[model samples]
Target: MPVVFVARKGLTKLDEKFEADFWAKSLDNVVEVIGNPDCPQAADGLEVGRAYQFQEEQSFSVAKKGDDFAKCMEQLADMVGYHWRMAGADGPGPFRDLFRHPGQFGTIGPVTSAKLAAEFATWDECARAIGKRSFYAWFASMRRMFEYAKTDGGVWLQYE
Candidate 1:
C-alpha cells in the first residue's frame, strides 16, 4: 500500500514583511518548504505542485545544504516511524498482534533484523508507501541548490 505523508515548511527571516507575504502566496501549492526572499526554490516548487521546505541562511554552501537535507530526511523518517508505532501500539484483542491489524496495517514492529526486513518488504511493495515523490522532490531540491551555487560563484557538478 502507498501512503502519503505531509511535511510542513517553515521560514525564518526575510527582507520585508511583504516579501514573506509574496513568498507565501507564491508557494501555496507545495507542502513543506521555506527559504529567504532571495532563495525562492521552496516557493517555486510549491507553486508547481511539489513539496519543499524553506530555510533562511547567509550563504549557499553545499555542505550546509547537504547537512540540512540530511536532517530533514532524519526528521521525515522519524515522523513516519513514530506515527506507525503509535497507531499500532495497542491491540484489538489477543490475536491482534499475531495478524495484521486494521487502521495500522503497514506499521512495522521492533527494530531487529526481522523487523527491518519486514519494513523493507512493506516499502518495496509500493514505492509510495515509504515515499517516492519525496526522493524526486529531494533530488530536484538538490539540483536547484547546485544550480544556485553555480550561478553564485560556487562549485557544482555540471548537469547537462
Candidate 2:
C-alpha cells in the first residue's frame, strides 16, 4: 500500500479547512499519488480508494518527492523489516502503526518532533539508523510540518 504524510497548518477543524474552495485552489498541487512515504514505490496495481489512509488525503503526495537511498534502505530493512515494527526502544516511534497495526494514525507533537529531529540529525548507519538521504527526507519533511505547527503543534500521520 502507498501512504502519504501531510503537514497541514490546521488540524483542529479540518471540516472547514478543506472546503471546496481549498480544493479548487490546491487541486493542481493535489497529486493523487499511490506509494509509501517511507519507501520508494508501493505495489503497482489498482489505485483503490481504500488503498489510502484518508480519501480526503489522497492529495498528500509530498512524501514521495525524493530518490531512493541505498544505505537508508539497508538500515531500515535490518532495523525494522516491516514498517509496523518501526518503533523505538522506548516505545512507539514514527511509522510503527502504519505497518504493524492498521487503522492506527499517530501524531508527533512539535516538542517531540524537535527532540526527534535533533536526535535524528545525528543518526547514521550505526546510531538510530534512519537519517540517510531518503530517510532524512522524511524527517526533513516532517520537521517542515512541525515548523508550521511551531512549538506546541505537530503533524498527524495515517498509513494502512
Point to the candidate with the largest TM-score.
Answer: 2
For model 1, give the 10-residue run with minimal summed lDDT: 102-111
TM-score of 2: 0.36
lDDT of 2 by residue, 36-143 (tens): 433211212212111112222212333442233223333444554433244443354443322332212344434444554453444333332444555656445443
Q: Identify the candidate with maximal lDDT.
A: 2
Question: Model 2 residue 147 lDDT?
Answer: 55
The pairs that clash in candidate 2 are 2-35, 84-100
Per-candidate TM-score against the hidden true structure: 0.19, 0.36
Tens-place lDDT per residue, model 1, 1-160, is 2222121223222333333346656743222222323222222222222233333222212223445444434433453443322334353322122122211112111111133224333433233344656553543343333333222111112111
- Residue 68 alpha-carbon offset, candidate 1, angstroms: 8.7
Q: What value does the lDDT take at residue 96 in candidate 2?
A: 35
